[model samples]
Target: MLEGLMLGLQSIVEPQHFLVLLIGVFVGFIGGALPGVSGTMLIIIVLPITYGMEPISAFILLTTIYVACVFSGMITAILFRTPGTPESVATVFDGYPMTQQGKAGQALGIAVLSSATGGMVGAIFLIFLAPVLATFALQFSAPEYFALAILGLTVVATLSGGDLIRGVIGVTIGLFIATIGMDPLSGIPRFTFESAPLLSGVDFIPILAGLFAVSEVLRRSRDDHSIKDTFQKFKTKIFDFPIIKKILTTLTRSSLLGSAIGVLPGVGATTAAMLSYSEAVRWSKHPEKFGKGAPEGIAAPESANNSAAVSAMVPLLSLGLPGGATTAVILGAFVMHGLQPGPMLFTNEPQLVYTIIISMLVINLLMIIFAKPFITIFSKIMNIPYSVMGPVILLLCVIGTFAVRNSMFDVWIMLLFGIIGFYFDRIKFPLATIILGVVLGPIAEEEFRRGLLMAGGDLSIFINRPISATLLGFALLALTLPLLKKVFSKKTQPPPVSG
Candidate 1:
């Protein structure tokens, strides 16, 4: 291990590799700070560029970009209400609120710090514990995956913000949307209505951009107030040591949880962030402060998502399994270079594997250093008036949505979802619930069917496996706790007197 680490250090310090690493990080920062351009998109765009490069250099470039992009998404989410990527969706709950309260600097500081810390922790795991964690992840079958999806969906209760019924309705709507494409098991279209484009299903990037970016623009357009006027005297500090110290517990807990979740195949940073946010709320001393600009709220999701983004590489490197879309793209890069990931790769190419892991540590530290100055610039965005900023944001959203698949159909989808998001916002429905359902619905549906097939159509398979049973039990508990609390509160209250 020490030899491998030393070899990795030697390889990364080479001028060519070091230069590519910086360039990759810079490109990723720009891409992820833009609405609708996710880390997956950035990597896909850069795929052809890596064709002639050496395998280690290509891996270093792509992985560095991947790590940096996840952290950069929070910049937009904190300064504006827009999530640069879906993984930053949870950040918007508290991050934007903090911006509104003129604490943009503080929010960005916490986000950057938490992201760096979480990323380092994940890199350490990737270095020393990748094999062990990957082995444990191998234990997950269809039933366990299904149960995990169910557990992720149960976060709707916490996301509802006291409107459980409305939250359920929102999630139902999202699930319906998710079912529009061809069924994974039957290979038949379910809700395409015979439209060819619908057969591909709604792209998540467009939906996410429309919901957060375009909807925010529409909301701001209706108001005559200027952000600068609203908070004329407000000044923000780059760091708040006291606040960081206060939220350290949440940060540590979320980082660990996110890394653990990231080891599971097909579960991405977005799910990790949502689960971390929900758990932070569950364990918080003042749960009511969540969604209201609490420091812990910003810390939890940012830390978790960044950590998850890094640790997600574990499955790909160790088990030859792509943990999420971004890692799937990385796997493609590996294949293009005539290298395959798995146990054999470790023994066959230990130097290259360790180089990638060690490069990630350096990339993460560089991100913090590179992003510190930008936080000040990003925070200044809040001072822009709605009239000027709204159109620019909408235009960016349109370009980003169109760029994804180069389809006008996706642009229309973005516009439609933008309006839908506006209405949902007006009605005070929880958008997080809908997003959770949309993201997790397909995973749950596919895994559930696969689990049933494995069990000869017996429903007991979900309960028969210990891991699956535990995850399902947790999901049920999460779903029922809110209702039980409401019922008990009502039961304990005295009857109202007649008027």
Candidate 2:
């Protein structure tokens, strides 16, 4: 592992790779600081640019953006009570309060410091845990892969903060979308509607651009033209050692919790951050200070959010499953590059894989420098109005999607998915699940069919395989546990007194 990591380090320092890494850091900070721009959206918008680059460089840029953007989102959440990303929502609880108290510097400092620390912890998790997971996954066959894919979809739906029915609905949409092209086993058109363009099926990039980026444009179409708000200005290094000592416990706890949660497929940093914040409140000596201006409050969620953001790579690298929306997009990058991420990737692309792991450490260190002196600069970037922001991003989406194949049909597909995405958003369906379902649906169906063929049409083959059965068991749990927990919680609640 150390030898691989050293090789990765050497590779990243090469001129081309290093330059992209720096660009990722810079772009991520600015994009994340913007209220309407998410790391996922930024990745999709800029994805086409990476088509000409090396796979390692492409991944380094996207993953770096993922980590940096997650941390920078707290900047706006702290300064303006408007979270730059959903993952930063918990930060606003204490972050903005500190700003209102004229301690914005301290809050920003604590948040950034904790975020960096958390990222390092997550990197450590990736370095140590991912390889082990990959090695174990080497034993998987078609049955196991199918079960893993099913588990991935279930986890996304269950943890995505909505009713199971809605989540299922989202997954169904993605599965239907996945079935648009030729059958893998049989060379037959499935849903082309006699259209030549549909013969190639739907491109993931255009649909992704639509669902995330262009849909964001329509989602913000109703907003006022100008954001008349400004940051509570502050000055200081984005680190404070004195407070770090006080919140060490919070940082350590949240970082571990975040990295662990990150391993669960499709459970993103948003969930990790909120859970960590609540855990901080549960365990704090002065819980009352949390909603006011508690440093621990800032540390807990920020640390977990960034840690989970980085560690989300673990599943993507090891299991071929994305742990969140941003990583799902990263998974697309892998596929675009003709690289399927999984156990085989570790064997086939050790240099690229290890370089990515090592790059996590680099991203965290660079993030401190990227954020420290540029708080004001990022603040200005975030203050740009949605009206202007929306149009620019929409234009980028069009240009990026069009560049992929130079086809107008692809552009039209993007627009069509945009409306689907808009409707999905209106119904409060999690986009991540649809991405997962679309990505995983093919894997599950393909693997199931392949497994059955291998088993000579015996239905018991899936259950007879130990690893496959275990994975399916977990999938069942992922699907049912959340609903069971909700039911139990409600039933255990004291009945309302006839109100």
The lDDT values for all models are: 0.78, 0.87
In the order shown, the candidates' Cα RMSDs to the true structure are: 7.6, 1.5
- Please write out the lDDT profile of model 1 over residues 1-499, one tens digit for every residue: 7787898899889999899889988877876876545676567556656766888888988998898889889987877687878789999999989888878778888888889888888888788777564456567788987887777566667567777788788778877888888877778998898988889888665676667566766776777646433322333453578997898999999999998887665567888999999999999999999999999998999999988888888867875556555675576567657886655577788878988988888988887788876555544554555566567656766776677667889989989888988888788777756666666677678889999999999999999999899988987987899999999999999999999
Q: After superposition, how far is residue 186 of candidate 1 from its true place, in Å?
A: 3.0
Tell me the TM-score of model 1: 0.61
TM-score (all chains, Cα) for each model: 0.61, 0.97
lDDT by residue (tens digit), candidate 2, 1-499: 8888888999999999999899989898988988888998999988899999889889888888888899899988988898989999999999998999999989998998999999999999999999999999999998988888888788665445667777787788888888898887787998899998887778788888889888878888866767777555578556466887899999999999999988777788999999999999999989988899999999999999988988888999999988877787888888889998899899899999998998899988987886777786766665567767777898899899999888889999899989988888887777777887777777789999999999999979899999999999988888888888889999999998985
Q: Report the CA-based lDDT of candidate 2 relative to the real structure.
A: 0.87
